[model samples]
Target chain A: MCGIAGLFLKNRALEPELGAMTAAMLSVLTSRGPDSAGFAVYGQAMPGFLKISLRGAENFDFGAMAAALDVDVSVHDDHAVIAVPLEREARVRALLVQRFPEVAVVASGARMELFKGVGQPDEVSKRFGLVGMTGSHAIGHTRMATESAVTIAGAHPFSTGADQCLVHNGSLSNHNDIRRKLIKEGMRFETQNDTEVAAGFLSWQLREGAKLDEALGAALDTLDGFYTFVVGTETGFGVLRDPVACKPAVMAETDDYVAFGSEYRAMADLPGIADAHLFEPEPARVYFWERAA
Target chain B: MRVAAAPVAVNEPVVFDLAAAGLRALNAALAGLTATTNQTVWRVKNPRGEHAIAVGVTAPVCIFVDGPVGYYCAGMNDGADITIMGNAGPGVAENMMSGFVRVTGDASQAAGASAHGGLLVIEGNASARCGISMKGVDIVVKGFVGHMSAFMAQSGNLVVLGDAGEALGDSLYEARIFVRGRVASLGADCEERPMTDEAAAILAGLLRRADARAEVGDFKVYGSARKLYNFHVDHAGHY
Candidate 1:
């Protein structure tokens, strides 16, 4: 069983506390998943630039790549977030492919920075300084690795589209069939994880001009299996569960924030939780809350 | 002359703080009790969604859990009266042999799955598969129940005071379902049967026992059509 926790702040005043709140929510769910943990934070966006989260090989020279790419890079453990001009994204990716072949672009967007690693949730959260992070929203996952290997590449909070991230708590039965169809549609995958296929499916739909909600609606018809998926986009936070909905999911919402957890204990200590509206997300329905862009 | 207040039977409840103690200890304490144990009242504090709060109890006791609970709160229960003051996770009273379990708040999927006997009551709505494969157990939901409820149920009665989701009873076997509100859709071989005098009496009894506020005449009864019981070759598509 995997655990998924997410926080979306409607009140910008809570942005500075997003990481701490999300970390606490994810920590209580360690028993649900203890092998690996991952998270994606959507912080402030810089005008005319994009923040690309990248992971490199052991002892990789990030400073040299920064010098060659001529971008602002902040190193954090084995991962770094590089700020590049929006126009230069293609050229920078090409250069990284040519020179720094060992560096993988984990996620690229205006505001989102994704980080994940193989370890206990506390260790992984500390490694990425998740408690001190400041963001408008965040999605976290701790995986027990049922159908895949326990590696960083197989961790969750997979971001296949810019500023869009997804974490799943249940397995997909027909991911391979969908994966083959997506590969034929020109979607490249970095791992054989079924969740990657789901993320890629959503990304493909969004790229095909479907709105976020529409993409999720399309997923209900195409994907088969038990799943409670929490997703984050540029301006929205959403949840979708399969028709069967065996996977446990509880949600709490108040004027301050909207939170999702695999279980209620994961959300019991959140701010204003005592007065929040708590309920379970229904089956085969898409629930989305968006911030005014 | 004013009568003195009847001597208050203050048997201070045996409190078990889940936050301060381990789950094993709490279960062991409950397990230690027999039918005639004097410690008949228990109060579980800070449940905080912990699982298996009071499972496999043979003692005739009353347990009041103060907060929400995780999966299988009262699994395999026998002769214990368990109540949750807050919501319950999946399989709240799963496989209960005989006892009484009630949830004051909503319950997740498979609330009383495959229970052999006893009465399970939910004051709030229950998610999918409310009483799947129930055998001789009685479930009364004051609110709605989700899809596939009472699926393949062999015997017993399920009463829902609110609406029911899709596939109310798929592949049923002699289990009776009574719903007060609309049914989204019925499952294969499950059909609405005209309420008879016996069925009405049964519904009345369950509502009286559950203390539910609903008219007995405003309900519909559903049970297996028995077409798929033997699995004829013509019914292969259903298989």
Candidate 2:
């Protein structure tokens, strides 16, 4: 009983408003998952630069760390979204691992930064300025804690590989067995959320040379559970549901952008929404749109 | 002399934009319609997959919803002719007492579930457990019906122009099921009954009401074997 919402900015003019729009969509789904919230915002990827988002304890000296590392870090509540040169990314990450062991690197992608917290969706979005961030495409989740405990680590938009993330709406019934297989395959797990296992599965599939559509369709055979998966990749996002389609998922596409929600009301208020071509996704079908590289 | 006043005859539709008025107000207005005087036409816009649209309208009215609807849309409807132009979520028109509800697209689980009276027409497929525990509703599905349809149906007519899913009419009672296509599997105590001229006439009437045309000979009837109602010690294992 979680909610998945995403927005892709087909129109570059709306890039600045991606965070705000995605936040509003996630907030509308607060009733579905009131325990915790998270988002993966995509910003422009500068050549030879890496963006690493880290979560630290309250009152952590993010400014001091930025000065020491000679990198730019913008503090948002307990998070510091740092943008550094590609060469120094390894050095800075190693430094954080050795000195600031408490800081958890949520995710580091070329154009995406992930933020998550344990609280009501609206409050968490405001705390992290999630509504103010900008990007080309983004995905967010409001979790109701069916698969694991309600903790920041268990929140969604779980990324197993760089620039690859996923948010799930239904429980993966066979996660425990699959988790062991993934663990044997040398994937690191930070939490017990079933959605994380799904993320790892996709990462493994994509790493093995499966395209987005093939990865999602193969999921129907390997993953045994009721689920509606909304996946975010570097180029674009895709949506898929179990054959039963027990989970709710709707998609709307206008001239400017493509939007996804658990219900249509989540997208009812979007700009140019009235003229959008809206429909419920078919069961067991992979509905995906990607921008050509 | 108590002659009931005629229902408000507004030539143009009274549009209820759910985006502006909210679902609560929309349902409240539909329920508050005068029982004696039935409104003529009502249009609901921006339903946007909201639940329970136009539920419990006892008045004789015609409702036109422009978008997809969530669970239990038009549930417990009575006398209102409701037409949904898009797909319906689970339990659409469940437990309807009387009236006509037409879903132009597919319907989710338990369509017309436990309905006592009314004619339900589905232009597309109906998902699992359709017409489960139905009482007296006359349901017509133009496409396939998923597994466990007509389970424990007490009394009703289910007319399927397409295939019926596995375990069709399982544990069925007096209710009759007319299947035009193949039955993947049959439930316990449900067996094929011979199609007669009388049953054919009834099916033809139902098809006509659903705005469908099919020869009565195309269907085969399935009903209870009448053995499960009485416990036989030797048949206990099957039961």
Candidate 3:
């Protein structure tokens, strides 16, 4: 099980202050996924994107890949930031596919970003500026490798396409079955993480014109075993608790904000939280929180 | 309304008279003290392993039991903090509302049973039936808990940093049970669920709050299978 957190601020600007809030919230949950920590910050100007961690190949050239795609790429100690042209994202994606196919595209967006690595929360925060950036909505993961190898790529908030990412906490018994189906549909995989298969499954449904909630519901139906996943997109976020509701998930929402975590303490540090009521998502229920159009 | 009274200052040596006091009296004396002012620290020099030493106090008082305590030492407690320096008997801090209850030594059955709120931090092992029927409470056990923990739990959080016994969370409701170590067996109507974003967030938050080092990915999720929610002939095996 890994710790996942996301905050969607309605009528609130995700600036430095909000970034600090996210950092504080994630800091309290450091023990959940001490292996790695990653987050995505959404903003107005940036095309939302997911940022993922990459290790083992220290000599990998991110600048060349960015230049090839005509986008700016910044490399940190354990992560890299890619800025994509929203209108020409498909073209850039083709370039990414052509080059550096080994490097997994974790998540993306003008505002959507994802970063993950192997270490404690403090280490990941220092490497990724997890506590420094700000956005109206953000999602994070702290992973403890279960079924997959404990590599940086296996960390969560995995993305299949631009502005589409997912973080999960339980295993899918039918991962291979789902993966086989997804692979047939042209979904490529970078790691052997079962969560990646789930990401592809959700994306495939969404690509078929299903709403985010409907797609997640279908994924839940198709997937077997204990799982609770949260999918984030450019416009909104969706949360699903499996039929058994085995994993722990608490949601506290108001008119202006919706905060969800495995425990209430993660939200204890959020600003403007006077009194927070906690409720678990009903079994097999798909809950969606969208930024008003 | 019998009340047991004991008065002692911080770092003061005191002897409790449990022979003359019942559970309600012990709680009254504890509740009457001012915890925030730090005027409520009492040391039990000769604890006779009595039951319900300090249950249901809203103050931030700290009571240190020098020796072992009997059942329900801090049941349904609110704010008063109690730490048993030695081992404890059954049902310590059952249905705790708030504050911190720590047991330095091992606890018998039903520690923090049905706790509605508060943080119950047990440094040592807790025996069977921990957090059973809990509602909205958070329990962090550094060691193992016995069988049927969180049984029929409606709401709250149970974090077992160590291993868990058989049939955990049998017929559970909405409570979230996170075990860092092994689970001997899952209870009836309990099935593993896919970990969602909300669950990941909640688990991560709990680890941080409990200061536990267990990773979210290393744990497994377990809850009711929903087949017995209303009970049907097709799912009669669960009964």
Candidate 4:
């Protein structure tokens, strides 16, 4: 079983503590999934600049790579974030494809920074300095690798749309069929993992002008097999479970925040959790919360 | 003649603070007990949704967990009285042999699943597959039970005081179900049957034992149709 956790803070006062709280939630769920871990943090957005999270192979010279691109970069373990003007994103993508073929673009958004790795959840979070991150909201995942290989690409928080990511807990049976259909529709994929297909499906729907909830509602018909998906978007968080709902999920909401976990243990440490309103998500229903822009 | 002072009675209930003591220590202590154990009362504090609390115990003792618990709480229990003061994760009292398990709050999926002998009382709602494959356990839910409950159950009874979700008691055996509220739909080979006097008595006894307050007349009994017990060419469409 894989574990999924998320925190959406209504109180900006708690923004600085988002990473610490999310790290604690993920750490508590390590026993459910120990193969790999990943997370997406949505912090304050900088005007006129898009943050691009990039991953590379071991010992890649990110500083020199940034200098060559004439951009500023901050390097984490096996990953880096570069700030590029909005107009130059296409040019940077072309350059990375031609010159820095070893680098992989993990995600691109104004506020979201995504990181993932193949290791214990705690080790992966620490490698990315997860506790020090300040964000408005965050989503995390720990993987047990049932349907795919234990690689970073197979990890969760898959982002196919800008500033939009999803973490899944169960396997999809008809992903190959869906993947073929999406490829014919001009969507790209990175791994054989089924979760990536789900992300691509949502991205395609969003591109076609379906709102997040509408995309999720459409997913209930197209996707088959077990799934409990927790998605993070530019301004919202959404949850959905399959109609059969074999997978476990618990959610807690308080005045300060709303939290989701694969199990109650993941959310037991949240502030004022004892008084929080806790409930399991109903089957085949889409629940979404968004902040005003 | 000097009589040895009575062995100091460990009268105070033993408080196992999960905040300080690990789960292994708690289960080890419970497992070490014998039928003749004098330490009959155990209080677990600050459970913090820990998994496998008080599992595989054979002694006849009373365990009170102060907060929510993770999966498989009191599983395979034998001759123990376990009570969870808060919500329970999946598989509460799973495969219990003989005992009494009670949850004061809502229970996740598969509550009392496949328990052979016991009495499980849930004061709040029970999620999907509650009492699935139950053998001899008597489960009483004060609130609604989710879909596919009592699926393929072999024996025993499931009493729901509130509505039941889709497909109640699908493909069941001798297991009897009594629902005082609406059933969304019946599963394959499972159908509602008129409550006989004997069935009413059984339901009354269970409600009393579980400390539930309900009118036996309000319940609708359900059981297997027995048509699927043996496969035949005529039933191939159902298969």
**DockQ values for all predictions?**
0.67, 0.37, 0.04, 0.75
TM-score of each: 0.95, 0.86, 0.59, 0.96
Question: What does candidate 4's lDDT look like per residue over B58-151, in tens digits?
Answer: 9999999999999999999999999999899999999999999999999999999999999999999999999999999999999999999999
The regions of model 4 sitting more than 4 angstroms off are B1-11, B237-239
lDDT of 2 by residue, B1-239 (tens): 11113334564577778888788888888887786544568888889778889998989988999978888999999999999988887899999999999999888778999999999999998987889999999999999898789999999899999999888998999899999999989998899999877788889899888989888888899999987888799976864
Model 2, which residues run further than 4 Å from truth? A9-17, A254-256, A271-277, B1-13, B38-40, B124-128, B143-154, B160-195, B213-239
* Count of clashing residue pairs in every prediction: 0, 0, 57, 0
Over A1-293, each residue of candidate 2 has an lDDT whose tens digit, in order, gives 88889998788899888988998888888988999999998787878888888899989998988887888888999998888898898899888898889888888888888889999999999999987788889999998987788899899889898888999999889988888998998888888888899999998889889998889988888999989999988887899988767787777898789999887767867898767876667677898889853
**By the DockQ metric, which is better: model 1 or model 4?**
4
The interface RMSD values of the models, given in order, are 0.7, 2.8, 13.3, 0.6
Off by over 4 Å in 1: B1-10, B231-239
Q: Report, to 2 decimal places, the DockQ of model 2.
A: 0.37
Residue by residue across B169-212, what tens digits does model 1's lDDT show?
99999999999999999998899999999999999999998889
Worst lDDT 10-window in candidate 3 chain B: B1-10
Q: Lowest-scoring 10 consecutive residues by lDDT in candidate 4 chain A?
A: A67-76
Task: Evaluate model 1: give its TM-score.
Answer: 0.95
What local distance difference test score does each model get?
0.91, 0.87, 0.73, 0.93
Highest TM-score: which candidate? 4
